[model samples]
Structures are given as C-alpha cells and as structure tokens.
Target: MDANSPTSQYASLAAHCASAFALPVARALPEQPAAVTAPWCLTVLAADIETAQLEQLAAFVSADQWRPVALDILAARADCKVVRIQLEGDIAFAAARLALLELGQSLGVELVLQAGETQRAPKLACFDMDSTLIQAEVIDELAKIAGVGDQVAEITLSAMRGELDFQQSFRKRMGLLKGFTEASLAEIAPRIPIMPGAQRLLLALRALGCKSAILSGGFTYFANYLRDNHLAVDFVHANQLEFDGGALTGNVIDPIVDGARKALLLQEIAKALDLSLDQVIAVGDGANDLPMLSLGALGIAFHAKPKVRAEAPQAIDGFGLDAALYLFGLNDRAIAALLDERT
Candidate 1:
C-alpha cells in the first residue's frame, strides 16, 4: 500500500497508538468507530493550566490525527479550560481518550472527556442522594441522633468503601435505629444540609430541558423532601423506611434499592424518557454507586473515596457538584446566564 494511502493514514494513527499506549494496533482500531458521535472535549478542573502544560497537551493532540478545534475558558476562579478536538482521520477513539486521561492525571489535574453530543445537554441526570445531593448521609445522621452514631458510621464507611454488602449494611444500621421515633427523622430531615451547588446544578439542568431523578440507597422520606424543597428533580426512587406506631420498625420496605436497583432504575428512566443511555448522566460517591455510574453516559464520582475515585470514569474532588456542568461543555458565563434567566 502507498505510504500516503487511506490505509496508511490509519496505519500511522495505529502505530502512534502502539508506541503511546502499548496496545496492539489491530485491537486499537475497531471495525466501526467508537460511539463518540460528537467532537471530543477535554476539561481541566481544580487549577489553572500552566503554559507548559497546555503546550504538552497541544503536542499530544498533534501527535495523532486529531486537530484542536477550540479552547474555551470554562471557569475563571479555578482557571478551568475546555479544549475541543476533532479527528482528522480514522483512529481509535477510546484508546486516544485513555491516553489523554492518563496525561492529565500525571499533571495532578482533574480531567473529563465527553462525546460531542454531551455538550448539547443531557436528557436525564440521576444522582445518588447521600453524600452526593446532600452534605451528610441520611442514615448516618439518623443513627447519630439515635445515639448509635459510632457503630452505624463505621458500618456506613465500610459499605461506601466496598468492604461490605450494602443490603447487609443497611439492615444492620436500621437495627441500630430500631427505637428512634419518627419525630427524630423529621428533625433530621429538615436539618440535612443541601450540598453546595446542588441547587445550581439542578436549576441548570431544568433550564436545559433535562429531567432529573434521585436514585438513592437512602430513605424515601429524605429524597422526597429534597425533591420538593431543594432540587428541581422530576423523580425519586429510594428505599422506604418502615414505621410502626410513629416509631422506627428497624426494617426497610421489601425490595430495597441497592446497587443493582440503582442501575436498573437508570435504565428504566432512560427508556421512559425516550432517550438513549448516552443521553444520561449519573453521579455518586460510594461503592454502591458503581453500577449506576457505569450505566450512564457519563458517571462522576463527587468528592469520592479512593476506590470510587479511581474507578469512576470521571471525578470531582476539589470542586462542588456544579463543576459537573463543565463536563457537559458549559462555561461559567453560560451557567451564569442560565441562572439569570430565572427572573
């Protein structure tokens, strides 16, 4: 084949892939393109990109057949940047993206890559309630007020870290709160702090015509409260805490919402909305959230544990939930404009 033939162009990309990623060239180039339908975006959060770092990134992109299309400053506060790139020839999309992610990580930068359509806005955004949409874990707060904070918190930690099964953890924790009154839940529910940026993110999603839902391992009482009072969410799916005589029954309703349920709920919601999985986004902060996170088009770990952070496709460690907007290619000015239209 001619060196400059169409096959040669792809061969060049494949050769670069082999040298850069240590992956077989044949495997890198798929028969059909990866499901990246939109232009690729590389978002940098948490800190400014030094001139040297930007140069490095530019050189990396130039090495392949991808061309840098545009650069937008997403946030001035953190000096966040979002670079859009377009492929100039047939290349392995996933492998190239993985290489970019590794490059950003090496620079201590939080990076997120999204399909082009992701910038158009998601159709549905699902969130894990505890430690995600809110500042505290609802069950842990209940346990604290019930005077079993230490024991329940330990179990909660283990479960979040993937050390224990979530169902067993929930049962054990509920048992510890067996005698707590329903009134205690009311008090705690009203006091649970709304996570910073929760309102902003929800409001932005609403303005974009996105339906939001809370798929939580937490109880329905708190999820409903948040949906009604704080977030502009359209749906809620969570485990119901059973009650007897205005006191805790120490048992959750049958068919608890565990990790598997969370993923299934994401699928159901997507289907109900007439949207594809790629049009959905899921955010969480624990091991149980893994399933739902992996199910969505974009899964983000928000201030997550080490294991979750390492495994989640994307993560927000030093920023608020609102930082998620950047992953969808929204800039600070665009978000501010979206918020201002409220009047």
Candidate 2:
C-alpha cells in the first residue's frame, strides 16, 4: 500500500502510538483506526494547587519540546484540577510521563499519563472490591466483629503485601470468623464506606456502554451488594463464604478467586464480551491483584502499597477512582455533561 493510503496511514498512526507509549506496536493498533485514534493525555490532580504551582506546571510544559496541540481544563474542583493536553511532534510519551510524575512530586500533586486509543474506552473495567472500590476490607471488618481483629488483620496485611499466600491467609482469616452470625455481615455491608469518586466513575463508564465487574477475594455477599445497590456493576466474581444455619462455617466454596483466578476471569470476561484483552482495564491495590493487573492492557495500582505501585504498569495513588476516567480520554466537560444527562 502507498504511504498515504488508508492502510499505511493507520499503520503510521499505530507505530507512532506504540513508540510514544512504549507499547507493543501490534497490540497498540486497534482493529479499526476510524473508531479508536490514540492521543496523548496528561491529568493533573491534587488536594489543592496554588498559583505558584500552576505557574510551575506551565513552565515545565513550555520548556518541554513536545509542544502541546491543545490544552483544556477537564475539571476544576475545590480540591482537584484535571487538565487535558494534546501534544504534537515526536514525543516520548513514557519519558514525558516520568517528567510529569517528577513535577507532581515536587509540587505535592498527582499527575497521570495515558496515551493510547483515546477515542476507545475499555469495554470492561474490573475492580478489586475491598480497598479499590470500597474504603474497608471485608475480612478485617468481619474479624473485628468476631473479636479476632488483630489476628486476622495481621494475616490480611501479610497476604495483601505479598508476604503470605492469599488462599492460605484467607482460610486462616475465615477460620477466625467461625461462629459469627450471617446477620453481622448485613450490618457491616451497609456500613462499608464506598470509595470517593466511585459512583462518578461508574456513571461515566455506564455512559460509555462499558460493563463493570468486581473480581474480589472478598465474599460474594458484599461484592453483590456493591454491584447491585451501590455501583450497578455488570458482573461479580468472588469467593462464596459457606454458612450453616445462618452462622459462619469457616469455609469458602472451592476454587478461591486468587490472583491467578482473577487474571483468568478477566480473559473469560473479555472473550465472552467479544472484546480483546486490550479492551479491558483492571484496578487493584494488593499483591494478589498483580495477575489481573498485568493481564489487562491498562492496569492501575489504585492507592496501592509500595510493592504494588512499583510493579503495576500504572499507579493512581494521589487521586480518587474518578481519575481513571481521564485515562479513557474523558474530559471534565464530557463527564459533567454525562452526569447532567443522568440527573
């Protein structure tokens, strides 16, 4: 095909995106370029930014040779500021992203860098329910109710930090909850604080016709509760906590949804949805979440631990879940419009 032909043009675009983002060239290219055109995106967030901070950001951008094509405010909240910048020229997206990270650190702000099929949102977004979607860990809460909080919490922390096997720690923790009444779960479920910005994230994803799933090592009851009542997520894959006569049996159903299982479930969901793995996004904050995170085209460590943040391809520690929308190329205005339509 001629260099200017449609095929060649698409190939060139794909090559540029791959080179910029450090993604595999073949995997970076979408099946239909008309539907998904990649673009560079920079999102700046913080609890607050001063005039000095803004001037610093501007100076940094101007000094860089990338030469942004457009700059717009995506959202400006009392505690946060999201900016969308489109760039021109042969830019190294990864290097620019690193520079932004350094800048954000210096300013005590959060900067997120995303470059890929900006026009195409992930078909499915899989989340780790406990810490990522909600503010508490169900197991630890259950342990607290059962008067084994300290013991179970130690194990839970070890498991999450990758010091112990998840399955083993899970069983040990469940053992501590033995004899607790199922009614305790009902009480705790309602009280589990949903993560800030979760509702908005789900709302934006719904508007984009993207399905959501909860792939958690937590119990089915809480996952289903969030999916049905809180987030309206499409699917949930979690371990079933076995109960007898409305009391905890200290056992879970076979085939615990460990890290490996989480990855497999992501693939299964993608296959079932008729989408590629590249069309999936996974978010989590623990060691067990690494498998699923690594499998997705876009994997984020959300408010994660040092280990997870170090390993995950992307990390969103300083911001809330709504920042994930920026990765999909949704600006503040677009999100506001979507929220208005829903209201």
Candidate 3:
C-alpha cells in the first residue's frame, strides 16, 4: 500500500498510535528503505487495546497488512491490560510487530518477545555436601588428621573438575583418610562452616513446604551432622567409609554414590516426592554435582567453579546462599518477612 497516498488506510494506523509515541509509528519507516522483511504475526499489548477491540482493528486493516498474533496478560501486573498479540502469515506483519514489541518493552510496557520459560515451581532442593553446603571437604579434613592432606586435596580438585572419575577419586582420597579416629568425625562436624547463608536458605525452603536433600561425593559422617543441626535434609547419599575395629579399612562400601549415582538419587527423590521435573531445584559447585544440577528445573551454580558456572543457567556469585531466594521472585522485604514469621 502507498502510505503517502491521502486515502491510504496505513496512514490511519500511524496517526492512531502517534500520541502514544509522540511520533507516527508505521509498518515501514521512511529511513530504512532497504531492510529485508520476512512474514510474521503481530501481537498487541496494552490496557487501551482491550477497550478498542484490537481484533476488530486487525480486521479493518487489509488481510495482507497485518494479522492477529496472540493475547496474553502482562507479566507480573495487576490490571487486565491487553498483552502481546502475535501476528502470522505475512513477512511485513512480522517485521512490523518485532519492531513495535521491541520498542514497547524498552518503554516498560511489560512486553516480552521471544522469551523462554523463566520460572519453575520447586518441591525439593538438592545440594552437594562438600565445598557446597559446607566449606570444608570431609575427605580432606580426614586426610589432614592422617597427615596426607596436601596429597588428597590435589586429587580432590582434579576429580571435582570431571577429569578423574568420582569413584576413582574417592577411592584414592579415602585411602589417605585411613586410620583416622571416629572421634575425628565428631570433631570436624561442628567445625565445618556452612557456606554463607546456608542455614537461612534451607530454613526458607522448609518454610515453603519444600523438602531438601544432600547427594554428596563426600562421606556420610558430616551429612549426618547437617541433619542433626535442625536442617530439614530429607536424604543423604554418599560414600560409606569401610570401618573395622574402630579404624578406617582403607576401602569404601560397595556401590559408591559418585557423580552418576548422584544423578540417579535426584531422579529417585523427585519421583518419591511425586514432584514433576520442573519442580526441583539443584545447587552445587563441583563436577560431580553437574549431572543432577543440569536435570533440575532450577539448576544453580552456587559460588561455583568456572566450569559449573558456565554450564548453569542461573548463577549466584556475589550474594550469600540465601540470595538464591530471589529466583522465586521474592525481594529482600518479602524474604525478611518470611524469616520474621519463623522467629
């Protein structure tokens, strides 16, 4: 259509929207003459469009000009504002809609064009025990008592990067922890500093009626301590140190729950809870945690290694463990209120 012609209807659409932008908005801009266009759909979004019968407006225009895209409620808004409309069929409609939607969203119109699913309901929170839920590595702590701390820590770092199989790494690390006292487990338990905001974050999840679990590559000794300290951890799966005569046997129990095993535990727990795949949140900072974390609805790299952070969809670097609560759409005030209710 020749928009410059006095009788052309395209002129009216521009004129109608002129007040909104303080400039005429049109399907084709005078400045961009050589832009290649593709067939697309136009979706309208705004409070004004609902009262105006936007569908009727689409019908008034030539079928070749534009087509109705979709109608949606604006994100996180109270009013029944007319949201995005997707247009289909013609390339001109697609180009025009994309431009307008981009512009509208930038103007704070609550417009989301081509956005992916951003939120998921969670029923369980899974954590990697060592260097994740707790700052100290249970194996390394044991190794220190054995006087092999430096040797074991190197292997631990390699295994956490996925370079060595977790089973092999745990076997080698456990050999070093051999002959440590059972009393040492008790000693390390209380000294194990939790990652920042760990307790508060777990408490928040519990208050939300969500279950928590630890699927660790570390030993079960420290895992038990986590549960005893008022953290509502529902499950603890880790390597069992083979002990005989009240001393380490330099072996682990069979069927060690390593990286692959941890992934299985996540699926099992989710199934046992009757929660969908999209209703689980997994957090960890090491290579072993990657498998389950990737499967979770909300996989978070919590102050993670570089590789973990690169693979994770969401990551928390600066904030405390409690900062992850933000992913649930809660602000500081809302979190404080939830914490307040518990007190």
- The runs of at least 3 residues in candidate 1 whose Cα sits more than 4 Å from the true structure, single-residue gaps closed, are 1-38, 60-66, 78-102, 157-163, 341-343
lDDT by residue for model 2 over 163-250, one digit each (tens)?
Answer: 8898889888888888989888888888999998898898889988999999999889999998878896999999998889999999
What digit string (tens of lDDT, one per residue) describes model 3 on residues 92-198? 42344345444444443322222122232268899988877887777777787788989998997787566887788878887777787777677778888888888
Clashing pairs in 1: 38-116
**Which residues of candidate 3, in runs, are more than 4 Å off?**
1-121, 157-163, 341-343
Please list the C-alpha lDDT of all candidates, in the order they appear: 0.74, 0.74, 0.61
RMSD of 2: 10.4
Measured with C-alpha atoms, the lDDT of residue 74 in candidate 2 is 42
Model 2, stretches more than 4 Å misplaced? 1-39, 50-67, 88-100, 157-163, 341-343
Error (Å) of candidate 3 at residue 233 is 1.5
Worst 10 residues of 2 by lDDT: 27-36
Per-model TM-score, in order, reads 0.80, 0.80, 0.65
Give the C-alpha miss distance for residue 235 in model 1, angstroms: 0.5
Error of 2 at 307 (Å): 2.6
